[model samples]
Target: MNLSIFFEPLNEDVFANLEKPRTLGSYISYFVSKFPDWRAADIAILGVDETRGRSNEEQAEDASTAETPARLVRRKLYSLNKGAGRCQIVDLGNLRPGISLDDTYLRLKEIVEVLISHNTIPVIIGGSHDLEYGQYMGYEHLERVVNMVTVDSSVDMTEDPSVPPNKRQLRQILMHEPNYLFSLGQIGYQSYLTEPEVMATLEKMHFEAYRVGEVHRSIQEMEPVIRVADLLTFDISAIRHQDAPASEPANPFGLTGEEACQLCWYAGLNDNLTSLGIYEYNPELDDRELTAMMIATMIWYFIEGFYHRKNETNFTSRHFTKYAIAFTEDNPDRMTFYKSKNSEKWWLEVEPLSAEKGTRIVPCSYEDYLQATKGEVPHRWIMTQARLG
Candidate 1:
């Protein structure tokens, strides 16, 4: 696919003042005078300037005049020093917004699907959170069940006609036909902001939702949740307003800047994660570009984590420690677990309900193994079993 046709070449004036030595901009293949050769790139940076998803007309009008949120983020990202990894990155430039919001979604979906099919991970920046629905659609033709994780303050499941697409995109994903979504895990949702019925609906679907306080208490626990995902969508609103004030509905209480980056790091290390979208940033509301800088740092951390991936999925290898626990007394049902010697990550094997289904190796934490050793079945195990059935 000729991706350049769908994109607008980045305005050089936006980044012209940047000093290139040792900075990320020096190492990146970007669209300036001509489109970069993205075919060989390992990571493609995509910018989306669409914001019509916002219900507030005033906010949308302001976005039209202000510098695009994506450009602001790119400026900050380019100024950071390059990481340890040899960068095979390409900045595809901002996608041209279509005449209608749904048109924009289809364009994004097509671009993301093509990028993933070529084994290039797309690091999407800007746009409203509803754009994630397009990101989710990218996986439709991949011929596998998808696991998704979203970091947001409120569940975007509103049924009200007055609500904009950004506020109800999750419902669209859930009801999307040909249902390839196997599991969805939400992180950093504030209880007060979420509706009780939405929580109940997610529970009924056998999905996972972690409260903001729960995530903040032990951010490390989120590693397993992120590791199992095939895609991750982060809403800037999930970060505290003080840290990321540019969001549509910036919350007073949410993940700290540090915690948000930590989650991105975990997402980067996951071998299964193919695409990432960070959304809902409005440059008009930013305080001296602090929110833009924060988003840039989060992207930097994700790239650092990507370079540090251990690729330790082989359980039978000598680099892993295996444990067999008998969780039942009468039938003595056995469970197998593996811990990576290199990265110290954990995984457990769950037996499928039928022969055709086979066994599943699920990402887990050391704490889960401790629970199993005490003659208890871990909740994660039970959840996986239910989903498999």
Candidate 2:
């Protein structure tokens, strides 16, 4: 696929002030005269300009127009120093929005599917949060179930079909068929901004939901949650307005800048995760481009984690220590867990009732291990079993 046909070339000035040596810009292959060679690249950057998914009312009410999110992100990224590995990254430039929102989604889906098949990670920036619909659709042709992890303030479901895309996109993905989504994990949700029923729906589906408070209490626990994802998206609105004022429908409470970066780092380390989208950034609302800088730092951390991937998920590998626990004969609940000797990260193993397959292992916290030792089952283990069923 010739990507140049669907993308607008980067403006000369977009790279004008960038430094030459050791900066991210020096490491990036930008689509200036032509599209970058994605086959040789490990990661690809794409920008989307469509915003029709945003509520028309909010678009009309905001006096200040939104700035091009991808441009702002590029400016910030180019100023940063490159991480320690041979990172072959290509910037695909901004995608040309289709005549209709659905058309744009289709274009994005096609582009993403091609990239994934080529083994290049797509680092998507900009467009409305609903643009993730295209991101989600990218997995349709893979023929395998995908686990998606999202960082947002709400589940984004609505009873009314006519609601804006941002409010109903999650519902759309959940109901999408021939269903390829194996499970979903939502992080950074605030109770005030979310409906109780939405959370209930996730629980009923045996999916994971973590509130803002739970994340704030111990953000590292989210590392395992993110590790399970094949696809992930972050809504800028999930960051507190003080740290990221660029979010539309801005909120005062959410993840801090540092916390957001940490989450990105965890995502970067996940070998299974292939695509990441950071959306809902309204640069028109930014203060001194602080949010843009914060986002750039998050990307930086993610790249750092990517280079430092340990590849220690294999329990049988010598890099990990295995442990097993058995409950009383009456209880009948037995569990196996693994801990990485290097990173100290933990994983719990579950066996399905059927003997057709081996035990399924999932990323878990140390607390889950402690619970298993005490003859109790962690909710995460139970949820994984339900998902298998």
Q: Which candidate should be chosen as best, given lDDT against the real structure?
A: 1
- Quote the RMSD, in angstroms, for model 1: 1.8
Model 2 deviation from the true structure expressed as Cα RMSD, one decimal place:
2.6
Writing each residue's lDDT as its tens digit, candidate 1 over 1-389 gives: 78999998887865676776889888889998799988899889989988888873433333334698888999999899998788889999988887778888899999999999998999999688999999999999988899999999999988786888899999999999889999999999988998999999998888989999999789988999999999999999999998889987658899999999999999989988999999999888998999999999999988888888888777889999989998666866788999998888899998867677978898999999999999889989888888888
Off by over 4 Å in 1: 56-65, 328-330
Model 2 stretches astray by more than 4 angstroms = 56-66, 329-333, 354-358
lDDT of 2 by residue, 1-389 (tens): 78789988888676888766889988889998977899898889998867778874332221124458888888998889887788888999988887677888899999899999998988999678899999999999999889999999888877776778878889989989989888899999998888889888999999999999999999988998999999999999999999999887879999999899999999999988989999888878888999889888888888788888888757888989989788776865568889999989899898876677567889999998888888888998889888887
What's the distance in Å from true for residue 77, model 2? 0.7
TM-score result, candidate 1: 0.96
- lDDT scores in order: 0.89, 0.87
